[model samples]
Target: MSADPNPHPTEPDVRPHVYDGIREFNNRLPNWWLFTLYATIVFWVGYWAYYEWFRVEPEGARSVELAMTRIDAAKLAATAAVNIDDKSLWAMSRNPVFVDAGRQTFEANCVACHLKSLRGKSESPTAIGPDLTDQIWIHGGDPTDLYRTVTQGVPAKGMPTWGPVLGPKRITEAVAYVLSHHKEGEPIVIDTSVSAPAK
Candidate 1:
């Protein structure tokens, strides 16, 4: 037995346990960190149980299932609300609600391909997508054409169909916006002050 309480002569030991010749130190983690770790583990376990076993929570997370549900819900809502015919969408060109919604949707999703300015990246050798600010559409500039284009997408051209991802409401809004930008002087019938959709 040595005079030193620590068996190892050189190293100042912090932990009780030691392996072969190496000393193990118990650098105790902060209370907040330990608490957070434990809390996260508990939360994960609860989430798994609630989502997987009981199925209590709604499908709000970003997943294929949620997207599909939203699409279906939008379709059903559309069926109940309006006819959504080509003329109707074109008529909504001046509606700020639809135009703004479309713009937001475009900015959120289309910006990656279409660029932030709605203009195609001129610096790039190959164009990722068309310059939306321009009127020259590879597909026709009609509202119905835009709607179909957005719904079905030009997959080969690298445009992913937005119908499933964004739902019909947003697609309709986008169509209206595109048509408004395409041609000049459409009826701006929507009353901005009105709380509900104008009949």
Candidate 2:
């Protein structure tokens, strides 16, 4: 007798397990879901290899860096040029455009000692320094002398050396402004007076 060709395949074990009646089914993931998961993993690996793991020197790095440096220098130079032109001696006096600038400078640097209104300190007078609003001259009343006084300073009278700080053009403006203040119809009186030295 020939054995039956259609023999039943061995039945898969389906023993029911009971642990307080809670049961878990042991089933493989669906083909479509498994394939999707595998594709996602593959895509992640490829992206990591291409961007992070790969080593490639960026193109145009050198030229781009050099161009950025030049642009910064040009911007700085433009701003510096404008500042220098605005503060020039001719621009400050004859131009009449920078008078406000000169006035601002005076208010910042001189107001503390000279007073905001260009009036000499009335409460406690400084014997060494001359009262600024007075027509009585300590330094010569000329613009050149006044400029020299501001730039060189009267060390004997405790004035600071404003030349290195204020520069030439600023010094001229500050002096002119001070001189103009004296002639504005207010003569300040002091205990003692000294003649200004010639420039």
Model number with the top TM-score = 1
Q: For model 1, how many clashes? A: 0
What are the RMSDs of all candidates, in order?
A: 15.1, 13.3
Residues 19-125 of candidate 2 have per-residue lDDT tens digits of 89866555567999999999999999877776557834323676688789999998777545533222343334543445556677789898767776666554347
Instruction: Report, for every candidate in turn, its global Cα lDDT versus the true structure.
Output: 0.71, 0.62
Q: Mind giving the per-residue lDDT tens digits that candidate 1 earns over 87-160?
A: 78877877888888888887788777777666675434365766665655566555676778888897765679
Q: What TM-score would each prediction reach against the true structure? A: 0.49, 0.43
Show where candidate 1 strays beyond 4 Å. 1-77, 80-82, 121-127, 184-199
